[model samples]
Target: MEDLKREGFTLVNGSLGLDLKHCQLVLRKIAGYHAASVVLHEKNPKCFNNFLDNVYSTDCLDDFGPVIRTIFKNCVDMISKWPGYGTYVDTLRSLEDTIVSHIRKANERDEAMYNVLNHGDLWINNIMFKYNEQKQEVEDVR
Candidate 1:
């Protein structure tokens, strides 16, 4: 907390409506992180495997399946009701099966393409920005 304060980064209060520049900055940072992890994994597969071995498994997904489906269904329904969102709603509904398959495949240890570590819970809350105080532009991301 003190480090953040010293760096002129305060926890942004209330809801943030990120503009295009903020989104681009965050995407670039995340992409760099992912690329670095992929390179590290390629350089030391054994180390990556050992690291993953100690991580939590998704065996509890069986219990959470219903909840996940319900959430997705609710999202589709809500989006469908919005004007000009029909195409998006259709695309989302169609992708439900694909999403489930991807999730399952993502958990498979044998899938080399999915071996790289990723931020599994990326959201606005998990990101911090160091802004240029004078210009109020994002200068750094953490």
Candidate 2:
């Protein structure tokens, strides 16, 4: 972390509204990380298997299923009351079951391709970027 700071990388200071370039840079960095992990797993399955054993599975969300469903229900109810948001509410309702099932199946160990390392929690706060001091361009991300 210190080395990253010394290299001009910083935690993003605040919300970046509609910043497509920055968003793309972050996505690219994440993609690279996943791709590298996939390659490593392919080349060294035993080591990768051992590494994955230490990581928590997404099945942990099973314990929060009720909470998730409640949140979605509340969101749908609130949004449904708003004018011109009926479509959004309907869409959310339509996808709710599918979303929950996907979450439940996400940690299944049968799919080797799905076992690659990934950022389980990706959000603005978890991302960091290096910026070119003079040009203000995104130099790197982690």
Candidate 3:
């Protein structure tokens, strides 16, 4: 992010080194986004529910559940090439469960917080950082 650069965030330009501090800043921003969404939902219920009902339809995933399960199962079967095969399979199973849980929770959360706009994607790549002149490393992240 240009703002981060102006602020004092130094980008390594390559994967040769880890930017721990910058990484933390990004993580914090992500957490803040999630928190903001939660707060927004608490403030507005009807709008949130309407948006969820209209936008994120469970029909999509549900209709495709068999396909997804098959893909996941195939991937799990192939993962035996790696060590701790059983552990990895267990983790994969847990991941599938988590996905289902998240979908259900998201539907409920959306209904409760229909006031704020729902962001389907709020990940690192969606955000940009910029450098600030006043800071040496990373300045402001946008």
Candidate 4:
């Protein structure tokens, strides 16, 4: 994360919309991080594999497609019973389908692509925001 930040990364508290400059700074950082990862994965497969774990591999799921479908199906079903959390659950179900499709496609292109060190919790609340006056936007963030 420090490396990513050094490369000009800044994460926004999604709940609080930032100025255009702030948004651009955050995007550059994110793009840099993504680019670095792709480069590293291609240049040093062993090292990359050593530091990552596949979250959506066939080994982890008996049948990748079915497992993904089942998870989404479960989410849809639960949404009906849990009215308070249903909206969130339903949204997640939609995301699950998208994520699964991406995983499947990535797997076909590069079987190792699904592996990465991911922060399991990635929600609006987990983030905090601050702005940089000199830059006229958001800068430092975690």
Give me the candidate number with maximum lDDT: 2
Computed on alpha carbons, the lDDT of every model, listed in order, comes to: 0.72, 0.73, 0.59, 0.59
Ranked candidates, highest lDDT first: 2, 1, 3, 4
Which regions of candidate 3 deviate over 4 angstroms?
1-19, 54-57, 70-86, 91-107, 110-118, 132-136
Candidate 2, residue 125: how far the Cα is off, in Å: 1.7
Ranking by TM-score: 1, 2, 3, 4
Per-candidate RMSD vs. true structure?
A: 3.2, 3.4, 5.6, 7.6
Off by over 4 Å in 4: 1-24, 51-53, 62-102, 108-121, 126-128, 133-136
Error of 3 at 6 (Å): 12
lDDT of 1 by residue, 1-142 (tens): 4577677765554285677887888899889988888788778767775556422345666556666777888889999999988979877888665555556655666663555577878877777778998988778877
- Kindly list the per-residue Cα lDDT of model 2 for residues 63-103, writing each as its tens digit: 67777778877888899999998878878888666666665
Candidate 2 wrongly placed segments (more than 4 Å): 50-59, 74-85, 95-99, 106-115
Index of the highest-TM-score prediction: 1
Model 4 poorest 10 in a row by lDDT: 109-118
Candidate 4 overall Cα lDDT vs. reference? Answer: 0.59
Sum up the clashes in candidate 4.
0
